[model samples]
Target: MKPEIIDHLSEKQIQELCQLFQSTWWAKGRKLPDVQRMLNHSDLIVALCHHSSRQLLGFSRILTDYVYRAILFDVVIRDNYRQQGLGKILMEAIINHPDLQEIEGLILFCQPEVIPFYQKWGFWGKSDRLEIMIRPAAETELLQEKAGSLMN
Candidate 1:
């Protein structure tokens, strides 16, 4: 069955997204309130839902300055839904989104195993001029979901 593609989600759907995040190793510890906050801070959101049950099946988001750069994040599909072209649907939707078409770059970070999958979209190692940097932070049970979160 064809899934419904949407840009916005309801409260219940937001909870569903948190659940989806849990299915992945990196996002395993995501919490509901944190997910809500993430949604509020994101520039654009893409979600695919089950046609009849309204369940979130695939999701991705973008942060862009509209003309200079855009970073794609959390591109995920439910385990059972993988290999069904939903990831392609999410990527095409992001690339073709009217608000993002003029953006000069789309960036994302993924594990090496999936590198080839994204090459079809023209993604590759960026210029040697810049690379990612990170710091170690302790985990929190509560009272801080965005300890290092910053979005505009």
Candidate 2:
């Protein structure tokens, strides 16, 4: 069945997304309340849903200035549903969405394995002159502890 792409999502749909995130590397510990709050604050949320059941087959969110920058987060497709071009469909919706049409940059970070997947849409890798840096959040203490132990 052809999935319908939508700009808004319900709480149940967000819960479904929380479940999907738990199965992935990037968002494994993501909480439902956090997901809800993020959805509430996000500039845009896009979902690809099964046309009949309205179940979310794919999802992504954009945090943008609507002018200078848009950062993509939590782009995912349900495990049983990958390799079907759903990601391309989701990206097309985001890239073509009027709110993002004039943004100077759209950015996302992904695992090395997925570089080629995003490059198809014109996303490039880190360059020598450009570096990405982040200040780790205090909320990541557990992850930091785990990594610290791994280094021991």
Candidate 3:
């Protein structure tokens, strides 16, 4: 049986998504409200759900400008669903989505173990001129730091 791929999610799906995040290492301790807000602000989200049960099977999200660049995040499949080509399906949907067809580049970071999996989709790590840099992307962290500085 095949699963359904969907872009938009409902409140129940959001709760289910939080549970899905629990299966992941990087996303451990992810809270429901924060997941909801993350989904709200995301540019594009792709998820594959079980055909009958509607349980989420695979998921990935993208932050894109629809032209210049995009960043892919949370490309994960259910623990039991790996090696089933579902990741390829999710990647095909994201890369070939109409809105991103004209985009120049897409970027993502993953554990060294998954480098080969992502490399199949043309992701390469060797870049001399460009490197991925991340600041404390969460606003709450910035706010807390500011408050601490003011109190000191």
Candidate 4:
């Protein structure tokens, strides 16, 4: 089936997208925002829906300035629809979008097991020059508080 891919998501679509995200293993039980919040924050959002029925099947967002770089996030395909090539289709649509075509590079982080899947789109393990550093939200907040106190 040829899915209908939409560059702009509706309010209802945003809610459904969040629902899919919450249920996905990658999200780790995080609660996503509602439609208004999503619209306010997303630089670009896309959704794949059934052509005839208009049911949302997958969704993704890109954070970019239409140049230099773009980050793909919240890529999710509904559980029942996996293995149907929808993920790849959605990704292709985003990467090949007219406005995004000039982007210097695209990046995303996924679990080790899915590295192969992302590799199909040209993403690979980082080089030695790249080092990833992570800080949990709680730790970041604690450090910020300490700094604030020290400055007082």
Backbone clash tally (model 2): 0
lDDT of each: 0.83, 0.84, 0.82, 0.76
Best by lDDT: 2
How far is 40's C-alpha from truth in model 1 (Å)? Answer: 0.6
Error of 4 at 2 (Å): 1.0
- Count backbone clashes in candidate 1: 0
Please, what are the lDDT tens digits per residue for candidate 4 over residues 7-114? 776666666776777775555444445445755788987779988777789988888877898888878898899999998999888878887889999888676778
Clash pairs detected, candidate 2: none
**lDDT at residue 73 of model 3 (Cα atoms):** 90
Best by TM-score: 2
TM-score (C-alpha) between model 3 and the true structure: 0.85
Show where candidate 2 strays beyond 4 Å.
143-152
* Runs off by more than 4 Å, candidate 4: 28-35, 135-152
- Model 2 agreement with the true structure over 1-152: per-residue lDDT tens digits: 57999888877788888999988765778899988888899988888999988888999999988889999988899999898888888888988888888999999877677899999889998778966655446657766763454233
Candidates 1 and 4 compared: the better one by TM-score is: 1
Minimum summed lDDT over a 10-residue window in model 3 is located at 143-152
- The true-structure Cα RMSD of candidate 3 reads 5.7
> What's the residue-level lDDT of 106 in candidate 3?
90
Q: Identify the superior model by lDDT, candidate 1 or candidate 4.
A: 1
- Worst 10-residue lDDT window for candidate 4 reads 143-152
Off by more than 4 A, model 3: 137-152
